[model samples]
Target: MIFNRKFGAPGLQRKKLAIISTYNENCGNASYTHVLKVAFSEIFDVDVIPLDLFLLQKPQPFINIHADAHIKSICAKLKNYDYVNIQFEAGLYGATAGAILRRMKWLIDAAPNLILTMHRVDVAETTSLIEAIGKSVRALRAGPLFHHFRNKEFSVLYHNIVLHCKEQSARKNVWIKVHAKREHRVIRDVFRFKNVIHYPLAFLNKEEQKKVKALPKADLAARFGLPQGSKLFGVFGYISNYKGIETAIKTVAQLPTDWHLVIAGSQHPQSIKAYKDVDPYLESILNLIANEDAERERKLAKLARVNHYLEKTEVVDERLTKPITDRIKFIGSLDDDDFVHVLRDIDAVVLPYIEVGQSMSGVIVLAMEAGGRVLGANNLSFAETRKYFGDTFERFDIGNHIELAQRLQAEPLEVEAARTAIFETYNIRNSVALQAQVFEGTYKNV
Candidate 1:
């Protein structure tokens, strides 16, 4: 049977390829890895090795037995593969670098054809070593010194080690790869690595696409106990200060009373504290009251009236956080199906990110895939994604709550139109085919 299967095959050799990542379970990274696996599976027997280095887990035995030794073990296993491709982010820089160095050493010892793809790097906007240290110092002075110092030390050590790997690779003939054009440009500008290659990340799989399409919008609202006609707005992924959830809340307050905002995903306790600390409603009310008083003193009665009206309009917002009985819902986390269903019911996906890198948003992608429109902060990545949908999506200035509210209010009809356009452009088949091309190119080059 095996002979018959190979009888007609001409000059076929199944190459073994290894793709490495620390955050393989993370949605965005996982999605990208999944696409690459599918796209490369035909030509190469792929092995996806998810490193446990950066994960929030207990330290593994071998990992604790010196970094170089752990890396050697990893390389020893990976050495048999025909091509090794590494996907790296600064989150797991030390362990990732150790693994890369070990692989490089093994390649130098015997194996070659190693490809390093930098997913996220240690830089100012993404993850800066210096800034982390600075923040750590401040954190130390503010509270616990020993814990903060240790954490900062680990980060600094990891960053230095990763930097060593990067410099070493550049000095040697190792090829460094990046996904986006902007990433490539930044890498060139910062590190000036000669062997950098620009390759865009892949899209979702057929099954994942189907899952997105099969999302039950109405069912999701029902599960969450949200009213049927509520104008739902979704904010997905890990909650963070920079994600602009507070801004989204303020925007919701500015909307009509019937409108509802759903903050999805598990909030980091720090973020919850930060939100409580900032208290956007109070901030807005104070700003309004101050403005109104100033206007009245200036004899600008019309302006004062406008400010007063705004304040009055926002009074209902205080009721939002009364309890679960209150309309505003904070669903901590959702399963994939439930998330999809919720996404479908949403009128718009709001990503008011203050800072973003080359990260392709799964929330925006899912919203678009589920036939919902997107309202993203004005950024290069968002702009690139918006290009596919044309006029369907709208962008708001980052950190500008008033502008975000105005855009949200004005663009409901436009969002629906954009939803139609988004479906046409980001259809799963086309996205998959484009990803397949990327895989084909990468495989051929490798």
Candidate 2:
């Protein structure tokens, strides 16, 4: 009786797809789910089953009780769907690994055909014994048993999740989807999960693409209230220490006076304090700028004293210092429309994220899609992304501001390799077609 938009009356009896994710929230996963829900709805009878983050992330003793009840309710709705996909990130399910795994198992059992899209895969590109030893030392100093066992515990949970998916594939139908090739290789080659597939994230839908207009650089600078001739470098997304924003600041400090940094995101809601005080990370950034200003003042005062002692017309070195804070700007968080426009208009998009085992970055994809020059940290995720997106962006070592500054100062990318790759290969239409194949069991990994 229901008419499908893509197909006519009767509509080939559109298959049902239930996406299990955190919807109605300002989370990145929620945004991704929303995009997919709209796109998939044209072909399938789609439903978004919201994940209760509050209950799942409850503190201590009450967590287990509430989490179980919450998951049970979700499992009850999933049985009828032709295909169910969970946006898996581990931490979103529960505070502890055991709690997360138990709930995941319940969902696996409930769905006839399940697909797990892993947003974060804890496996490293390569293991280092020295890194393990360093963590152990830090754990000892921190005096917490949780810190000591955290890495090992996550490793166990990751393997168990993959194995569970593999086991489920044997009986009926189960698939594991990852955002990057690195994660796919790890699951298929490292953990030996045969059902794993790679699907790069699709950022700009039709509406979003329409919003992205390539404004002149002068107009963009005036809009953001910056010097007309200043070179603007920007970092987007929620403010977090892992974003490696400090490295960007340091890089700008080493650049020419005309070069400036624009931080275009505000503090994450989770990072906000109860009393409305700035979070520790945000405070650290402010203090760093303040300290730079004070250091400049101190040098100026010292120079003044030296000038007083010297003869009136003595030749002085032309080098002078100014407050670094003046060159930096915080434009705060932007809505979806402005985000794409600003990303396109900026001189370069800098991604200085430190490795936290992230499999996907929506910002990076969006940046590339907007046709901007992207400079990313040489972390595993970005390195893998370059390989996946056809070597689209330039890379600098993580936390090495000197290297980053040098890269930015050099010629901007005249060619948009990543953008071309995204448009021609990893795009929204292709992504939907691939998922359709997946749902029909006709998908093949090439």
Candidate 3:
């Protein structure tokens, strides 16, 4: 009978919801789970089970991943819960689709009321005949009927996924939820999953919203060491390659000194692991990033050296070019309260991501909810955000430095108007309430 203050725990027992996630881990899905756990706590007696899906390891070097222990663990644990929700991302679970499927199949058998929320589904909007044929060939090779024949783990994954999806498609309680609309279309149209749930990703709790609105206008110059009265633009979350950080960096160099860029975060620990495990090709790309980051560091060091030399000589060396890289600053990662406070402080939040296999972005939702002007890449996720939230955001071509720069140079969004659209359209409570209600209906019918 422990009573929670923020969200009252009812005297009578509430329905149980077991959220299966790497709750202690740092990932976008984990963050989302934390938010949902808080938001939905009012309705259900919520509990979390740490499913260390991404921490999969092989029995031996270059041998197959020993996923059976995890499978058995999930099946046993989930049977006791009234309802189970899996914060699923295929890549986050296993190295390949087949590897992930093996884990999911266990859940499909164990919990009838299991709901899987997929974060990524790569179904290109259009395809060539050859591409279609190639996919079909792969599907046949990887399908559960033929998975045993495939030599490499990678080749069999997608095909087996299609087979597993088809098998689970007819299950009433086994709901496939996705965050974006286009992803919903792909599930329904491409995979022929008629029961796909187009659930909107929610962010910012009532307390966080109150905190954001009550945030005092702080001295940004002193706090983050930026110039006084500079119009601060920001990029949030972990620094990654496809995140288009280079474009943002280059774009910052072109902007006026008054238009400062504040990178209000660092690389997340889990993301560092994801970079290592997900793709071998990404290793070479990351080496290039390391080189680029080194170059930036050198510029900063050189700026210091040149400034020190000039202080004594009191004259510019004619051969040396003066550096104008002072405005770009990287404030290390902040906790949730500080993140909201910092997000509330910024003039705009820029998402300059290149086209990639993301179903949706949690940042866009959070930024919109925080009542700031959002500038996002013109892709499926951002486009959906614009379509739903109206002029709360603007779009630029993905990785297009000139276009991104042009958008930044444009007049800033009116604060009151942006706040209005965001609060009115997509607050945390409304989205969560809708989800809980719909989820209850599913429970009843199931």
Candidate 4:
């Protein structure tokens, strides 16, 4: 389905740029789409098409079979655009692959200059034939009669299809470039695609940057009801088991009373329930909250444990799993204005991601752009992230609660200076201009 919004003057020259993503209009995905749309509009006329591939006409025993049909329909329509930019992610085995393959086929068949943004491809996840077959059966029963395919077999098939698409595009002299540098490097070394161009993902406008910059740290602290003198540590983005929210909580539990942690993302209700079920300490906290005397004692005990961990650098695993009592506050999901407000008050941003791939980190980039110190996980992707920040950010081992606590306690001057350098290197204006340059160069070559 296509929805067109014509803005600005009618006579202005606008290059037709098609952005394709399967993301539902959720906040995180919407934020990404919004940024890209703004950036692309600044450079050319942009059309943002969100393909609804999962919608089934009828309820059935399994997943919807018409998913591939929706993808093919979207692709066939994309032939109208001057350039097609596909956002590729390695998430679902069956549906995602079908969508990607259909879109890729359009790139090959229609021969539009294609720019594939490799977002977290090559990431491994659990899969089984039974699961795939079940989903497939559900889809088949839903109408459109798509067959069930095995997960492992589908994955191999998808990878080969992508590789073949790249090769065929190159053979046809079509411009097919990739966005992520590290992923591009690996793909080049393995698949040897001559048409691949390594372009880093970037942020949006200067107006947005200015708005974020104008927010005051003191005002943000006041808004959040945090102590005026307390140092604030922030964890931004969607909370998941692998994103290391637990580690941040543990690190906060180990910090001095002057340090407060603000977890700014909405909790995944499923993951929270799962965590509570597995951790007795979490269950205990929930149980104790009902009784006045017991709750008071439990709160004190939790505070004492936090204090002890801070004083002795001892392990704080059990205390970390307990739900937020006082020191850690859940800010829930923040709008752009509110997010900037919170960032203004934050002393540092902590990214304790367990997994890393070709994906870009908005939180890390935003914190640096807003002049907040960052402490990120030491991963291959972060190594590249560090180049953008230079000395402004610190890297700690993925799950090192103790080290994170120490860094939080240390001075922030050096980190702030490093952040300034990062801002110079990765400022949205420069990054977007660089992307425009890449697009122009690719177009000229084609």
Candidate 5:
């Protein structure tokens, strides 16, 4: 009757962990959450409560359960569970201080043993409230600052920081988990959250890693229709603008014609409707075309007029002025197997993201498991993760196309180093063990 004593929960089989999320959403958050639920279910009796944004009542049994009002009923259903884990992002609930507060308050009233996994923790422009107020006052000096003080950025940055602080303060007993060590540091040091734990996203096992590498080397020329003996660089994730895909394409244009870049995944189904401006994918494509066509700026003008939606994948967008139609492949969304295959085949993986705030990338973790050489943007999240990365890992300035081109042209780094790194740091067994330790520690200390 002793199940998972190593977790220190001697009778863990009797305990249940409820993972609340928008269960079937197309975003990475949903996909990652699903995987975590599967991982956790092996240790604890788990339930996935379909909790999308605010609603008055359950629209088809937990599918559209209200973020604010319907929490009491959701809690009643989850009352048997020992703990509740909420997959939290500000915008996911509702992108307002009042909205997030209302939702969180509902959860607090519903469940006492709560664990919060913050996908993106908001770090204010200025750390202290005094500094924020000072900045706001300074903006008043620079001519009528009505809409936004200095910049037209999120007007509620100060508001969000305050609300987040209040949320953490109220949820002192709640276990706060973040993906990277840096996030742990930021939350603990800057925000001063006492109840915080840092563990990486659980990823592939050694066996799964072997499967990808063991899968007979992909024939790029034949399978994906690239030129023979050509270098294939890849960016593997759903298409998003901040991913610096424009930077990726621009870098590809700089490389030799034989060198091809495959945008491994399609536009995220959610992203097509998410952004207020142009689609992030289209924005990236149009930016590339704008750079390429200095004279015949027809594509640029036409695309600029488009408020939303690009029905066609304009050839000029992905080609990069190099007659590299066959070279630059926008092979739409792929299944898990194909994604792994692409990771295995690619020479190097470029993460040229502009401003990445997340603790760790699901894509980067997968690439590490597949043992692909990674060239990442110089940022804290990756820098901290670098400790666990091998010699194959390299970081360049964010949005620097030239440096990325130079690195991509270099010989592919040996995957053995990364494979070794993967086994040590990003393996599934290790992640599970860590979670067990965390779960036990939470109860023991409290």
Candidate 6:
């Protein structure tokens, strides 16, 4: 009995596909899996077997019998499917790197044809050994082991996993899907994987694209209880330190009085509930907002005193009439539909992220696709992803609040052409076709 099956024509028998990923969780993996399921379902009979994060992610001080059994049971079910796709991320499978690798090997053995989408492949950082050691020592002095050793461990685990994939691909049909071109080269050239696929995270399907209607900026401002004429700059996704939201806030502080900020997402649940620790990131952002507000008040008060002394008519600034804190709005976490709508509604999406070697960002892609102007830090991830976006996605120096402020005030680049280019290149149909061709042995990999 042949476990691997090729695709027939439309209306013919469909190949059975089992996707092992987080389905219902509130993570990027779940969102990616949903879109993957939707795209692949057009060609294959898709079943999304949710990876139980709650059970599998619990810290295993010793040999975790339950996690081992869980993996075995899940693998046992994969025998029924023609192909299995696992959304491979380090943290999703196990609490530790060793455990994740063991489970991954087990899953690989169970399926005849496996397609693994590696979300983050940190094979190595381009840091000097001395620099890395110094940084690691500083990180160790600060707190958790992960602060310094994360990249070291991640690189080792990723290398081992790719080596395992290269081995397995030799025996049976196995494919590794990566998000970036650099990652593709690393896996194919360095790891020597024959079957490798690379594509940006394309979430907005044709239908989703049609449904993405922009709520007018005026209406969004009204809904968020801001001035109708406010020039709203937005920073999206979870409220995390690495997002560089403080830079966005500082940018807004430096901008004209009409400028305001809308922080769309709340603190990530994991950041809050992970160690039962206080959310310092959130507190720091709030404190920055307060400081900016006080600074604004001081400026206005000085202006008022100057006007009084000169006996000149006090020209009140209409925008600063309200408290500065009011200008910075936090609407909390939004649903999928609301997210797209706000993406379109904002004046410009500000991504002041500090460099952390992120491979891709769904927010950046979605913002451009939704016809919103984007301003991101000139990080490597943004630069690489900018190939798909063209000149429409404006970039600033990483962590430069003044640069961000100046760019935000400047006229945005024309996005209609960029939008057209992105849609033509990365639409849902193209993505589905490429993956289907891979499955059918029709697409050639370089």
Candidate 6 per-residue lDDT, tens place, 1-446, comes to 11123434566888888999989777767877888888788778999999877678877655467887888999999999988888888888888888888999999888878878888777665566667667768766533333446677778888888888888888887888877887888888877776888888788765677556433343777788887777788998888878989888877766787888899987876566656556888988888888888887888888899999999978777645656687788888777767878888888898988877778888888887777788989988888786666677888998899888888888888778657756777765567677666666677766
Minimum summed lDDT over a 10-residue window in model 5 is located at: 146-155
Clashes (N, CA, C under 3 Å) per candidate? 1, 0, 0, 6, 1, 0
What lDDT would each prediction earn against the true structure? 0.56, 0.79, 0.65, 0.59, 0.64, 0.79
Off by over 4 Å in 5: 1-12, 53-72, 127-173, 268-281, 293-321, 324-326, 390-392, 418-422, 441-446
Model 4, 270-346: lDDT tens per residue? 23443354444333323433342344457667777888887855454453343445666667788875675566557
Per-model TM-score, in order, reads 0.64, 0.87, 0.75, 0.71, 0.75, 0.89
What TM-score does prediction 4 earn?
A: 0.71
Ten contiguous residues with the weakest lDDT in model 6:
1-10
lDDT of 2 by residue, 268-299 (tens): 86675568667889999898888767776777
* Cα lDDT of model 3 by residue, 283-393, tens digit: 543454455456656766687788798775344332123233466677877776677666767877889887655667888777767666788888766776665566667
| Model 1 TM-score on a 0 to 1 scale | 0.64
What TM-score does candidate 5 get on C-alpha atoms?
Answer: 0.75
| Residue 102 in model 3: lDDT | 77
Off by over 4 Å in 2: 1-10, 124-148, 205-218, 272-278, 312-321
Model 1, poorest ten-residue lDDT window?
A: 1-10
Higher-TM-score candidate of 5 and 6: 6
True-structure lDDT of candidate 1: 0.56
lDDT, residue 48, model 5: 89
Best by TM-score: 6
After superposition, the stretches of candidate 6 with alpha carbons farther than 4 Å from their true spots are 1-11, 125-146, 213-218, 274-277, 298-322
